[model samples]
Target: MFHYNATNLPLQGAPGSLGRPAKGAAKKPPPRRRRVTLYGLTFSLPLLAWQLLFFLAPLAFLVALSFWTVRNFQMRPDFDLVNWATVYSNPVFWQTYLRTLVLAVGAAALTSLLAFPCAYAIAFKLSEGARRWATFLMVIPFFTSYLVRVYSWQIFLSDHGIINALLGRVGLGPVPMLNNTFGTMVGYLTLAFPLVVLLQLFSLVFVDRRLIEAAHNMGARRLRTILEVVVPSARVGLVIAALFCFILTFGDFVSPLYLGGGNPPTLSIMITDTTKAGQQWPRAAVIALTMIATLLAAAFGAVGYAYKGRAR
Candidate 1:
């Protein structure tokens, strides 16, 4: 073998050498990265435009409306704190706001309680075909118009309606149902239960069945397995379900308007009443902004909880 100094060895492609590329070398083309980025931007444009037009633009206008003053039942362009002051000063508004919070929290809690078991059964216990059927049944109620469902509930809860009629036949006087907190909550649950159950079912279906089986084999009881293993695993879904219920119920005017009376008015109803009575757009906007702020805070909290649970 001919011995050669490493420093004196001619490099590849040196003078009089064959210009072959070094083996196993790779080069990335810059345009490939730009193409990928361009593809992502192209796909995202529709969604971005939709949000800007329908959500952000409307929200911006609403915020602007909230700051403007309303004078003589006509909206004035002058910015003032008067609308906010009126909202804060009114005791009735405060009472209504608090009541709305109570109703939303209460309904969400109850719906969660009712939703989890149904979702668990559908997700884990049922066969695939059975799960599909059960899911369909859960959504069937929603196929009916929302307003029609609310009106149906109104009829069902009325003094002479189906529930009261059945109760009266059992020798009990017609319990107060329509235009009360109880009735309002029932209506909220009726509308929200389907959504809650669906969300929770979607969550539960993705949970590893093997983990649940392992927990069971370790002598965990049914309730313990669910509480410790299943619930923790599905916490994100549970949070989403509860958040949806709370947000929907919090902003619902129709249920409280038709089923609940003035004694326990919700913020949505209060906003409507204020708008109808005075055409006070700015004040209404303040109330709207308050509700928006509250829901946003709730959304942030739910997202934070979900992400924290996921992180763990």
Candidate 2:
């Protein structure tokens, strides 16, 4: 029997069969707002241990050591500003800093120049199969150790080496390609160029070929097509390549050390020897901090370049 009026159905659980749902029905509650937290002593303890041991502990020590003084090659834990003062006062420090900056800029410029042409060829001129092989050849050097590859320049440019010997065969005197600033710039270019090309290749794939065709149809010649059509399409790629070139070249320490040697004295070598007496911690920290600051500035410059490239 039913007792409900026409106006409405029975209320929930009011009684009898009319008000009640069937047995074994399932109900869902509202969704919950989740919070992310690292859980478990077993799971998180190792990560926490590593953060303290490898990261925070060394960083704290380095910061403290930068405030310390060195006497007779002995590191005193007593805080002092002598290392900072000494580093700032040295004329050699500024010279090395400026010289290295120039070399890095040269490297970055050369890398961009080479990468742009190579990238354009790979992206536009090559067939699909050829492009793959070309890309592989460009980047394969990176798989080898940078030291070994850069050292190979010595072998090629050495008096007894391949380039000179080839010149000897040609009855022309050997051109000097190794030693001094020119040689160091070559090393920087060789090391950084392939990476720039690789980065640009990714951007190149996004370029629309139709845009070039449209430009050509509108009386644009080959040079004009590149400047007006292809370049505009690939601007982002070029900026990306330039950014990589700058960062890699500026941050590089090894190329100048081995190739340039202490005669020219790049920033890297100067920072190391000058910062250490007995306690190497403080001056080294300052050098490290300076390098970090320069790197960050380069990063900001890259972002600006990318934005400008996009706008173009």
Candidate 3:
């Protein structure tokens, strides 16, 4: 009988002698990882370039323009405090800013109010197929051009428009719904409602139905279950919708221009009229900067709230 020790087996085929790797040696990393990273960069480069070209570059130019002066309405590259001083000291700017803020906030609130029940029905009550159809119907309005839709609202709310004409059939006089803040709010709500519904519906759909059932099993009431469980879980979506509406409405020039009737213009309209119509680029840039800062602050606050909710 031959006594063969395992340690002496290397004599037959030593590690690395028969083209096998050493047992304890580190293997070379495959080049495929680097290729994957290169591929990712290649895919994302277009988006990065677009952001740099259209967004960041223009934002930088606008910031620089804010600090520059406009001599006799000709934009100059020289630094000056005159524009900032003018914006800060002007009562009209502040009033317009406040009005725009109020309108934006009001519209966002109303949109949220209207969206919640619709979203709840879609998320909890409707079958999946019905929900899909409902969502499609909600989104149908967006297929039309935004300007045309807003203009349609202008016609709808006009003195002799459909709404007023309907009221007239009921022996009611024409209501003043066009060319004012109320009309502006109606327009904002119409545009923003679908977005709010979609966001809230997404939030509601993903909520663990089990949690609500669990709460109810513990004798929690329907409203209490919703207020305590559903609302907290959907806070992120709510915050996002509110912030999006605020940012969009705050910066909206077109709706205000078309609907506001120049009685009490929004800050966005003021910025446009100042820059393009009045040729006050520096002042317009200042207003732009202010609007940007305000939205950024709101966004940061929303992020903080969301983060805190997550942490809790």
Candidate 4:
């Protein structure tokens, strides 16, 4: 056997040669991980293109238009503040906007209240099959044209129509449904009701049934069980549903147009009239911009609360 003096193993050998295989070349280490450029780029490019072309570019144009002057035959450019002044000064516009805010918030609250029970029914009482059918019915309204549905409401809610006629036979006075503020509210409520119920129902379904049972076993009443066990679990859903209802009701045109008096206008009506009749696209754009901002703020606020609640 050949005896080797081993102190430092590489003492008699070239640097890094001891215990290493004799080689003509050094082995390369495994390649470092490189991000998949194609996948990330492909995933993001289309959405980026869409936002740039359709959303941001159009928004830029609207902002620019809102400041410029309109000539007799063409639009002229200069950053003037008259459009902003006119919008703020008009009392009808302000009143209509205020009324719309009140109705939107009220309708959302009412829908949520009505929906809570229906949600309970589906979550706690109804069989799975019945719940499925009920949920389908709630969603079916969306399958039809929403405008057509509102128009159908106009027909049904009119003073001479079936709803009023049946009520009249029961000795109730005629409902003044067509072209009134009350009619607008009803129309919007009818449309919003199903959405509210569906959202709450879906949320309630996702809650843990075991917790509800625990509440009941603790001698909580039915309402108390829901309050203590169910609502707490589904608070996020309620917040989101309220936001959706508020945005829809605030921005809706068809319900107000078919129901609101032509002269005394809702914000939606004013937006349309400005664009079509008055030919003031700049002013209309400002209203549209403001409405969009309001919607974004509400949605984000709800989302923030949901996240904060979840964090806790």
In terms of lDDT, the best-performing candidate is 1
lDDT (10s digit) by residue, model 3, range 186-289? 77876777888888888889899999999999999998998999988888887788777777777887677776675688888887788678668878989989
lDDT score, candidate 1: 0.83
Clashes counted in candidate 4 amount to 0
In model 4, the Cα lDDT at residue 220 comes to: 98
Q: What's the CA error at residue 226 for candidate 3, in Å?
A: 1.9
Listed in order, each prediction's TM-score against the native is: 0.83, 0.79, 0.85, 0.83
Pairing residues by index, what is the TM-score of model 2? 0.79
Q: 221-305, model 2: which lDDT tens digit per residue?
A: 9999988877767776777677677677666766776666547777676666665443576787777666767878877876776
Instruction: Please give, for residues 1-312, the per-residue lDDT of candidate 4 as tens digits.
Output: 222335644435433344355556765332224434454577778998999999999989988888877668456777998887878787877787788788788878877887788778887789989988888888987566888777777668888998899999999969787888777777777678778888888788899988988888989998888777788899888877877788889888877788765546778878888888755787887787777777788788878987674665
Candidate 3 yields a Cα-based lDDT of: 0.80
Please tell me which model should have the higher lDDT, number 1 or number 4: 1
Candidate 2: regions farther than 4 A off: 1-32, 37-61, 272-278, 309-312
Scored by CA lDDT, what does every candidate get? Answer: 0.83, 0.73, 0.80, 0.77
Give model 4's TM-score versus the native structure: 0.83
Comparing 1 and 2 on lDDT, the stronger one: 1
Record all residue pairs in model 2 with backbone atoms less than 3 Å apart, i.e. clashing: 66-282, 73-278
Q: Write the per-residue lDDT of candidate 1 for residues 71-180, one digit (tens) a residue.
A: 66678787788888888999988988888998899999999998898999999889999999998998887666777788888678898998889999999968889888
Screening candidate 4 with a backbone cut-off below 3 angstroms (N, C-alpha, C), the clashing residue pairs are none
Q: Among all windows of ten consecutive residues in candidate 3, which has the lowest summed lDDT?
A: 28-37
